[model samples]
Target chain A: MADPIHQFEIHNIVSLGSIGGHDIAFTNSALYMAIVVVGIAALLVGASSSRALVPGRMQSIAELSYEFVADTIQSTAGKEGMKFFPFVFTIFMFVLFANVIGIIPYTFTVTSHIIITAALALLVFLTVIVYGIYKNGLRFFGLFVPHGIPIYILPLIVFIEVLSFLSRPISHSVRLFANMLAGHITLKVFASFITLLGGFGIAGMAGATLPLALVVALFALELLVAFLQAYVFAILTCIYLNDAIHPGH
Target chain B: MATQAHTEHPGGKPQFPPFNKETFASQLIWLAVFFIALYVIIARLAIPRIGGIVEARRDRVEGDLAEANNLKEQSSAAMAAYEKSLADARGRAQALANETREKLNAEADKARRSLEAELNAKLAQAEQTIAGTKTAAMANVRSIAVDTASAIVERLTGAAPAASAVEGAVADALKR
Candidate 1:
């Protein structure tokens, strides 16, 4: 069987010359990322250009996406959090489009990669830290201290708090990356099984049908997971950003 | 050398190239580029238009509701005015009926009183005429009785009394 992992291989598409003595070549990942950006821009911009009071199908879809992200931010972060609406909205659309696009046959799932997810998580992490400190100053550190803990348990609790606090980005990134990675891999494996079994004989072909059915179900599940992961990523960003907005609670 | 090693890696290891350190720069660079591009597109174009549409719709709905409420109030006021006029018309009609009733009653009273006065005058005149005829009847009766008394005297004793004397006798007898 062919390598299922082969689907995720990044190829250097346009080998741009070395920049600052390092290979800054445009890669397949980069091409798709550009496509994601342009595609989202085109869809949203083109849909909204008519500015119809009674929106058409594309306009409704576009508007729904805007409303979805807006509601997520408003619910998690409140009115004050709306100042960062553009950034939060941008990231949600970016991740959501990437995930949905990745589900297409033979397409690379960008969010499945640890590097990309970690980078997205890192951006949220930094925003929380910077904004927290900027807004709350020293009180931002107080997030580690539980309000009602007894004096003896306070130190232990604080230690756990600090530990968990440090692990936020790791969990946040891994949650999405791991789910996509595992789901895609499982899909690939099952799809391969159908081929591997079908090649054996007539009886093997009948047996292959089960794996084929499973592959179809897994595809549907992955589509749901794609949307779910984008939502999780966006909401987590909101929750973390809330800590920045409100330092104590 | 690094590129060769990456290419040579076996599939059994599940070699995720994104995890490989060599590609971090490229992914990060592209992530930055496209993300900023998306951010700019969304911030500048998408938000303003969508937000505008939503806000405008809300404002229009509120304005329509307010206008509806105003119209409702005006209708009620007009209804009240109509009701007041209806009541005024009814009162005026009642007053006119009362006036007509009073005038009819006054005219009936005047006619009845005059008819009663005229009838009373005619009864009194008829009474006076009957009294005069009775006096004439008495005068004839007295004369006839006197003549009859004289005729009887002539036939029985061959003596006749005077009419004056007979009348005086009849009168004196009547007086007694």
Candidate 2:
């Protein structure tokens, strides 16, 4: 069988100048991210420029994505949190597009890497903390304090709350990265079976076709997971923003 | 599928890469830079455009509704004016009809009074003519009576009675 981890090797696409004795190199993943960002910008701008009273299909898709993020924010975080709608919407689209693009035959799955997902989760964590502190001043640290607890158990409750608070970035990043990595690994394994079994005979070739069929089926399922991961990420961000805005409730 | 594998390393020791904190920090810096760029685009460009579009749409809808309400009110006012004019015409027609009836009534009353006065004058004239005719007939009757009595007295005593004697006899007969 082929080495599964070999699929995750980062290929340097462009080498820029060194920054502080470290190579500031750009890779295929960075290129794809840039492409996703540009594609989204063009889609939104082109879809909405017409501003038709009756929308075309592309416009309808753009509007649906907007309304989806808007509604999710309103429901999860209330009207005051609607200001984050565009940010959340862009994040969802970028991740969803990147995951879908990776499913193509020769594309790299950027989101399968822990580094990418961890960076995204870290940004969300920092935003929540920084914005909360900026808005509420010193009172933001009170998020670790649970209200309505018995005075004697306050210390234990604070400890648990702090632990859970620290775990958000790990859980958020792992959920996306693990799902993508497992799905790609499975596809790679099944694809290897087709090559290995085909060398034997006619029956071996027929058996190889079975793994090929399974790979096809799993590919379809992975598409759904890609979209779901993006949605899950956006909703979690909204929930975290809510905690920042109103900590106790 | 569980075939035996040969390894260069005899012991089952896992091979791992060196953990460099500088590399991790460099990755973190790149991630932070990318995140800041994304944040700037979201805050400055995309969201404001979307909000402007929404606000413009809302203003257009409200303006349309306001215009429709104004037109409805104007139509109602025009209908009210039309109704008022119709009522004014009906009032004028009623007043004209009452005036025409009064004129006819006054003309009829004047004609009746004139006819009654003419008839009263005619009756008084006829009564005066009847009194004159009775007076003439009385004179004729008195002359005839005198002539017939004188002729009878002449046949018995050969002379006619005088006018004064005749008058005295007549007056005495009327007294009896």
Candidate 3:
């Protein structure tokens, strides 16, 4: 049986050179990332090439993705959040395509890595801080201060609020990364069970059908998780950005 | 498999692939590069085209609805004009029938009155002619009775009696 953890190992495709003590090289993760980017670009660019008044299949998907992201932004962040549409839209499509592409057998799951998801979550976190300060100036600190709180416990409440506010990026990144990592690992574990059971004989092979069925069901679940995680990530980004736009509530 | 993973990495012992700090730089750099590329493609090309299509369809549908409403108004106006003409025709036909009936009734009245007057004139003339005939017959009857009485007296005496005395006696008998 194949090692479940072996799938996550990043291999160097090309060595770019070392800077300081660290080696900077293109790896399989980078390759898949490039594939995701190109795939998204080609789908969008090619689908809109015809600009058909009545959309064909691919164009319909392209339009649906666009409207989906737009609606998510509008609902969570309101109209003023539209200025960050490009940024939010990019994050949504990138995570969504990366996740969906990773579901295919033998493909590297980009979102499964902590570093990648951390980078994405931190990007959202930093954008919220920077844009909130830029738009609201010192009033952005109002995000940590609640309205109608009594003066007696205000200090403790402020401390807790700051702590939770700081933990947002950690939770946001871990939620996606853990979901992908665990789902893939479980799928591999169940798949290996089928092989282990089948090696016993014809009766063992018959018993292997149970795990096979579970793996099939898990695959379907993972597919849902892939879409759901992307949605959660995008919506959370919108919510965080909303705090920037409207800091108090 | 664990031993293979250990050999796969060049430095020291192999760490868990995700936790390995060695490759973070490459992933971050590439993620930045590709994310920026995707952002440009989506913002520059995809949004404008899709937004334009939706806007155009909305305008077309609104225009079609306005034209449909205009046609309905025109049709209702035509129906009103047709109904007004129908009412006018019905009123004119009723007036024409009334005028023809009145003329026929007046002519019938005039013909009946003239015939009644002609019959009355004829009846009066007939009554006058009968009265004159009756008066002439009475005068003849008196003269004949006088002549017959004188002849009877002369025959009984074997000679003729006087005519005035006979006439006077016949007149006196006729009066009685």
Clash count list over all predictions: 0, 0, 0
Identify the CAPRI category of the predicted complex in candidate 2.
Answer: incorrect
lDDT of 3 by residue, B1-176 (tens): 32435457767685778888998888888889888888898889877877676667678889989999999999999999999999999999999999999999999999998988988888878877877777677677767776777778877887777888988898888789
- Candidate 1 structure quality by residue, lDDT tens digits, B69-167: 999999999999999999999999999999999999999999999998999998999888988888888788777778887788778868887778878
What residue pairs clash in candidate 3, if any at all? none
TM-scores of chain A, one for each prediction: 0.96, 0.94, 0.98
Between the candidate structures 2 and 3, which one is better when assessed by DockQ? 3
Which is superior by DockQ, 1 or 2?
1
- Please provide, for model 1 over A38-70, each residue's C-alpha lDDT reduced to its tens digit, 9 standing for 90 to 100: 878877888878888788898888889888888
Candidate 3, position A93, lDDT = 84
Which lDDT tens digits does candidate 2 get at residues A1-249? 885555554545777767777666676666666666666666666666777655678766766777788889999989978877767876787678778887886687767777778888887898899888888887887888877889999999889988998999999999998888788878888998999999889989999989999999999999999999999999999999888887764
Q: Rank the candidates by DockQ, best first.
A: 1, 3, 2
**Model no. 3, DockQ:** 0.45
lDDT of 2 at A60: 65
By lDDT: ranked, best first: 3, 1, 2
Instruction: List ranges where model 2 is wrong by over 4 Å.
Output: A1-8, A16-24, A46-60, A82-86, A185-221, B1-34, B116-176
Among these predictions, the greatest lDDT belongs to 3
